[model samples]
Target: MGSIDPPPIKLPSIKLDTTLAELYKRASPKTAGLRLGLASCGVTSAVDLTPDFQRNSRYPYQDQALIKVPRRQLTLDNTNLRKSIAKKYLSLIPQRDAFIAGAMPVILFNLGQSPKQIEHDRREAETTISVLDCAQRPDLIFCPGPIKIPLQPEQDHGHGIDKLDYKVVLDGLEANQDRLTRDLETHWFLNSKAALARSGLPTPRSEILETEGVPPEDPESCCRVCAAAASSSSSPGSAAELPLFPAKCTGPRGRWLAAQKDRILSAARARPVPFVFKTQQAFGGAGTWLVRTAEQKSALLAELAGDDSDNDDDDGVLGKLLAQVTSSNAHLGPATVLLSELVGADGDGKTVVGDYGLTFVVTDRDDEADGGAAHFLAASEQNTDGSNAWIGSTISYPRQEQLRRKFEGLMRQTAAWLARYGYIGPVGVDVLEVKKSGSGQGETEFFIVDLNARISGSMSLPLLRGHFVGRGLTCASSVSIVAKGGRAGFIQRWRKPFEEGRMLILSWYEDPEAGESIAEVVIGGENEERLQELVQRVRENIEEVTL
Candidate 1:
């Protein structure tokens, strides 16, 4: 895509604070070309394209993580997920970006969409305020078309990866000669659960699961549940007579997969909430599902057992899982997924589970000194809405010390693992502190739940929290809200704090006709009390206008 003529809009006067400036310098010691405009990797990353892979999983059932599915569904789901990111989340990228433009001083994004649709979203975002880099006011670039550069000297226009699919964003950037070698390092390892298993860090019992349709010797052999094993030799998985799962393999491999699935299904039946299925390269909490109830387990297991005669009618967790599978008759395999223990819930393991986001910066340096080398920026507790989706984050630099100590060893190990791959950028690891479920909740367990190699979704929380890195005002909060207010009304309502520099607007996406906007904002305060009070007042003010 080509850069659009930036509409003439009022620019915010961004006064760079020395402390905040230090973070930017540290994040990009050599270059200030932090790219936020790259096309994003959505819900799923890889399509198996072939049969079941040789497993590197720790658990037996992990070998069955990849199953054959229809291809038509896979392409459609991929298209929809990418479109949603380009349309909705594209506007929210600049909130933490404008406030903390240190790491990403320049934003580059190619929506690869119709220019009209691209401009439509940009206008709704109030781009000046939404993409405003209050720290440096970074140069903005938006091209809604594919790269014209010589990516593949061998391939023509529509065939180049840049034009074929912008799904893998970095490939397009590198084609333009941006030195992003560090970003490419170890991305595959860090992208999946394999990195965590290999890191030897604290994590839940995780396994890579894969499923083969049937034994090549007996493609017609149907699993007891498969009503269509003999439907067509084109898809043996549809009618494979496998146990515990809808798939089947006749020999030793089949038995191994059966045993694995059996153990997992047994444990799932024994416990209320026992498993979480994590899709590869999924972002913004889109592909994480908690199997918490016996009912949910029953429904999910039934789907796994080849109960697809209903035409994918179920709108539950299993249905979502099917979306990534090959849904067409040709090439019916699903993308590889991860199955892990669902640590802490009510009966379903939703008890006192403390979810934390620990963000740190990795620089290319061989420090033979004391404290772990990577910069552990902020340890923010994630805030989730009623649906348990991440809504915001409450980060505190001063408070992060205790968390660092508690998970110090774990963090160091993680940082070392990332550094080993020559990766030097922002990395965030999600952690969970679980209080024992039964027997008075006396015991505790800590598990590293997620590893984000690149700049994570909530990574901007640090830019706002970094304001008080050394100073005493350490408490920081950032949240996204859908409030009823027109552009003028919304800004005027918070003008006092806006002018006073007490509260910072991260993003504002206006829905003019609906009289509402979804905003992501952060505020710095002297203490947690003041932070809470200010947030309440902001909410009250916004709520008052809503009525």
Candidate 2:
């Protein structure tokens, strides 16, 4: 096992850390001589959802080359920045999404872009227990064959989680009519950032820039971003004709944001340095942006308002797209938006402390009298980029007592809050140890930034590291890795760690045609500094897999 180590930021790769995003996956961590699974999902039926399961992304940034370019040198060219970011973004939809194959034992996924790649991933999952020697999860069910999705034109097939085809989902439900899904409604408010601003919690200060209007008994069902998470048809906020929001902006948040348009437009004009402009629902960092400069604010607002007059060329277009990812169409209506205060960052606005993802399990007995429980599974420090898009997660807290002391209370309160709403499942919260901007720089504050209602991108970090918990290995970190060969080489390269029970390969997606693969891995180490040598060794091993 590996101890949590310094991040591989200097390596030739792109990362945001799962500032890491949300992907609802059920995770079971070892507890008191027993194994308890939260959100116990069984795959009684499989959705040969293989064909149409591509992810829905608004920007045209799906080129891997773009991601390899140094951040400082990156420009908006048709080169390739979008590809890695887009993949990272897709890996983080709010619900059970792109990389659930990693967290859950019973894998349901769309492996890369092609059917051939899907076959590779399917093989990996099928042979996981045998190859890796890890215990098979209780809720294990291997779907039949690697269903080959026939190639089709872009318009004919539906994308992955964000814009899945309702027809496809319902159609695949031919046999397993009884779906085992959680009650997202009960906990939506407590976890959503848009709602967090209104909730009375020990959280960072925030105000709604946009939100849903005429609440639908349950606001989550009507929220454009949340509603639109599963598919365009997931909510009425999404028009049936086109995958767009309603034309008129009627939400009060819209009115509030518009009224403050002048303030927002000139927010960074002078500059004490502004903060984040987050669209209510987004994966990866697509929905999050930092308004640090006037030029950035202009480009952001221009992008949001659908005005290209100020957009220069492909270079300008790429920058605008990366800066603000919510489609103009979504913003055409009252989609949820927030103007969040910065926390956990240095005075100059750089995030020195980085972000942390807190994962908790909320459980309840039907007998209301039996009061429920929320267990703190683990916490991972998120690795992100200048834009704040999350790359991966790491868990290397040597100060065990202090780690639990600081976050447990908040997680307990959060769980209690969710239980009150009669919700049960797993929840992930993103928080930061705030470094006060002004005179109070010495005094730090812990503030909640985002509460993920579903299994988060980094929720698997703890589970993956548990294999080495008893060992002397003191830390662990998860990173999305790209390699020359495919999963075979990945497995071969890290087989020793797998056999040694010191590492885990949670997710693997290989594109054979492209002769490349992307995977999410957890590396164990003695401590952060000592773990660097190990992290680099594996990184190089994985990167040069083909050879």
Candidate 3:
């Protein structure tokens, strides 16, 4: 929130390619093209493109194909899926398509259920990605946001839509759509949170409270209506009413919150252990803190009540934090505080992190799940530190059956919840398994961490291998190739194991400068030793080849 300069405006540069020229010749010289924003955060771009293509069966148009032009550079450590996408584009899209000049075919298909009708009335077609030339106005341009800059006035030389005729799609529509989507997701999370509580799952106890004016000073005044409704539902569970977690909705006010924080701090200190505090609106562990001592809690409250001089810009965020804390019994502390119960480590002295679990997705074709092939992608995983652990390094594959069983149940529930909320894309539910405290029996306790609502890291694993398991591809044979190389020199490495039909090579690269390259090779074969060997060889090769 500090004083920072606004980013400079950028102008678009058209890169004319041969394929685009050919596309211009084939389509009516007067025909217009449609360009959809396929950026990562955009709606249409979130759908899994490969399955969409297989399901739809028809390439919409030979000359007009969907493309994903990333606004970034590619690195040597690209994933196998990305490499495959690049190769596919190089082979499919011709070099002479006129209307599609400079566009990269990162994806060949556009998949998303469209509204019943699209209006084509506007004279100036608008998009987030600027189309430099003003003469060729597309009949309909679909982008995720509103246009910020005006197009240059010019006349078309008989190439497309009449000069000075284009339409603009406002950003308000897309923004509203995204907001609705987030609301729906929040509702789903709420329902799932209730289900976990009812099913005797281990989750942090919480409640929802709605209030008028600023939040009340007394926590007892907060309503428990949402919790009551959830508990009374006719789901399969014990008939006894369960204790509801506190959830509160409130307006903006500093005085009410200052009083409430004092009471919450006293109540929290009365307990044996310190409590964890979080802001309602914050995501990804932001605005969360652990309060362990009265001194620290008092300091936090002082900061909240202190005058705003240097941190005036953070006042809005601080206001939201105060509202959330006072609404319920949650407190606010220093960002560096850590007061949660310490979960024990594994036998090997390593803290056991949660499984980076992902949902196995099998899309329904004709409303039936039978014919659709399942593809697995890794989703976000919850680590011991309450942060998201992605695919490559943070988490290792869960090798124990006990851990896997607990994770599988969590995943099943997660997938069901996602399906209910109209999300057909690849999803994942990350959960952690820690040893139960004071049990002495070494029983593992499971906790639900976070939900990933999109295609995750594991999605590419299965695809890289010939067989798609809906989570990851098995590359046992490919792993063997690396394993064999470990016994020999790095220069004599064999690529044949990865070439095996069963193995999936996630990535492969050879750098000239450092002479070092890395690849994510998955082992799919049944042989454990062979897989181990392949992993060793790959590791060794990476070390030797890299400068």
Candidate 1 structure, TM-score to reference: 0.64
lDDT of 1 by residue, 411-502 (tens): 67777877777665667788887775564746766788888776555666555544444335668777666678755565566666555455
Best by TM-score: 1
Across 1-547, the per-residue lDDT of candidate 2 in tens digits comes to 9898533221111111221112222221112122211221111010111233322232111122222222222322312433343233222121122223222323233425567655654465444333332332222322222222211234224221221111012222222222223232223234445666666666756656542222222224445553433364455433221122222334432343334443434442333446676654443444566776667777666655434443222222222222222433233222445666656434544343535788867655322332225556677777765656566767874654466666766776777776676555567788776555553556555677777666566665554443555666788777666777876666566666655555656655455556876666667787787566777787665542110
lDDT of all predictions, in order shown? 0.49, 0.44, 0.31
TM-score of each: 0.64, 0.60, 0.39
Q: lDDT, candidate 2, residue 303?
A: 50
Write one digit per residue (lDDT tens) for candidate 3, span 335-432. Answer: 11112332332232224434545445523222222222222333323222332112132222333234344455555555455445444434445555
Poorest lDDT segment (10 consecutive residues) of candidate 1: 54-63
- What is the overall TM-score of model 3 with all chains considered together? 0.39
Name the regions of candidate 2 deviating beyond 4 angstroms. Answer: 1-51, 54-107, 110-121, 129-135, 138-181, 184-191, 211-272, 306-334, 344-355, 365-372, 435-444, 464-466, 491-499, 537-547
Which segments of model 3 are wrong by more than 4 Å?
Answer: 1-39, 42-201, 206-274, 290-318, 322-406, 418-423, 437-442, 455-547
> For each candidate, how many residue pairs have backbone atoms clashing (under 3 Å)?
39, 30, 53
Per-residue error (Å), model 2, residue 8: 29
How many angstroms is residue 204 displaced in model 2 relative to the true structure, after the best TM-score fit?
Answer: 2.4
Q: Each prediction's Cα RMSD?
A: 9.9, 12.2, 19.6
